[model samples]
Target: MSSSLHSPWQRHVPQIQRKHQHWLTDTGSLTQKLKNHCEQFVVQRVRQNRAFLNLSETKSLCLPLGRRILQRQVLLICDDSPVVFAHTVTALERAGRDWPFFNQLGNRALGLTLFANPLVCRSDFEYTRICAQDALYQIAQTALHTHHFKVNLPRHIWARRCLFQHVRHQNSRMMVTELMLPEIYQLEKTSKAR
Candidate 1:
């Protein structure tokens, strides 16, 4: 199915519910937040390899379809529950120069590095609700299944993305997108009941 059939991303933050707003709009490191909320937090690297960016990504990064880029996919598990699927893309030429430690992030949370860096600037967030037919939805589900997580796929998954750029390096850009799993909202509900 085409991406047009799915919900398109919106830049408006107010569109999200107030409860989820805190999680979606927070500018702080997501890794740290997850750690605070869960007894165990782990980053499971699903795949890290060179790949071409999708059409939307290509347009966002101003690159062509055939252009090679470093693609990294990981699942952020909190308290043994898979809560988020994160996908990052960076132009191969700029990967090393912009994010020198990118290649070394083995099972390490990228949010910790990006948020800690004083030179890293993040663009306004864009939110979307992805259906089962979306490529990203399949990627996320596959990652979960690969990790032995029970996959009763949801009708739609909420996600957000933003572009990151090195302040001193104009050519260095990285796109990070995260799909929030059902466990995330379940955690929120449990916390509220406490």
Candidate 2:
């Protein structure tokens, strides 16, 4: 991953609309929120495979290079609309030992599992805004196209990330990053109008 792509992850939430800020700062399960928002909710597993962790991810997980890790990317859809694109990474060794379900979570909301566990402790949120040129922006665009969401693409997208650590196991940690799509804001507007 390019350093520029990870350049703007802020420890504090950026100046954004209150609707977007609510989604970014919420400590609750995003999966549950999506379920509540739409009659149809789906988790689309876009890609899940062994890959080398990026520099920021390696530093967060305290793992060295050459050791492959499990990287899973999924799209959270509500009412047939792609609302969020999530990218998750976990150390392969620690995942198998600590989070055995990491490999088996296909088309299932990882948030449901993580939030349900009392032992899973999440770090503070880090916010960022991604432009069209960013890697995550391209991924979100592709997901929207693949899912056939008929919405206008904005020049930039807002995102947030955090590190989740298992309380009992010190070495077990997973980094999850979520990119909020334009349709999410549209949903908020529609709900408010209703």
Candidate 3:
């Protein structure tokens, strides 16, 4: 049985999706540059010969080899895959080394494993540093802003906080697979009321 009823904007959804896809692909170079910048920060800070970084569609930080990697120094930061984040932690702990590299990382080394996905584990902690995004400071600048009836600011902000909060609690791991569509069905009515 067909679950969906005929929707007026069924045709428009595809167009909107195409636009977003185009935007990401067009900015692919810039995204790569951004990822490179993030890597540079870690490389510059850690003076380790054996360092491995993982980049995937879902963005996850992972340890290259499980038990074999115990002797080497590895730091993982997975933006597209939180599963990598969880696994890295588990592997590191299993390796059972305090890892001198942690001295170089300092506080930056404390938190990096994300638990929200449940796929990531604390054992990867030896090689993975769990860190949470500074959502409040990141949004505090525009905490109070002009209203855009087309976009509900309150709900948007709340959702962002919720996601950030949940991820932080789980070792700052976040994998945004889908866009959070704004509930602006009443946008026209809200705009008219104003």
In order of appearance, the predictions have TM-scores of: 0.91, 0.88, 0.17
State residue 145's C-alpha deviation in candidate 1, in Å.
Answer: 0.6
lDDT (Cα, tens digit) per residue for candidate 1, span 130-152: 88888878888988998899966
lDDT of 2 by residue, 1-194 (tens): 44336456778878997756788888888888777777788999988988877765667678885558888999998778888999998888788888888889989999999998899999998888878777667876786777677655688788888999999999889999998887777654235224
Off by over 4 Å in 3: 1-16, 30-59, 63-194
State, as a TM-score between 0 and 1, how close model 3 is to the true structure: 0.17
Q: Best candidate, TM-score-wise?
A: 1
| Candidate with best lDDT | 1
Judging by lDDT, tell me the better candidate of 1 and 2: 1
Angstrom error of the Cα, residue 170, model 2: value is 0.8
Misplaced by over 4 Å in model 1 are 1-5, 14-16, 188-194
Deviation from native of the Cα of residue 57 in model 3, angstroms = 12
lDDT of 3 by residue, 145-172 (tens): 2211122223221111001113223433
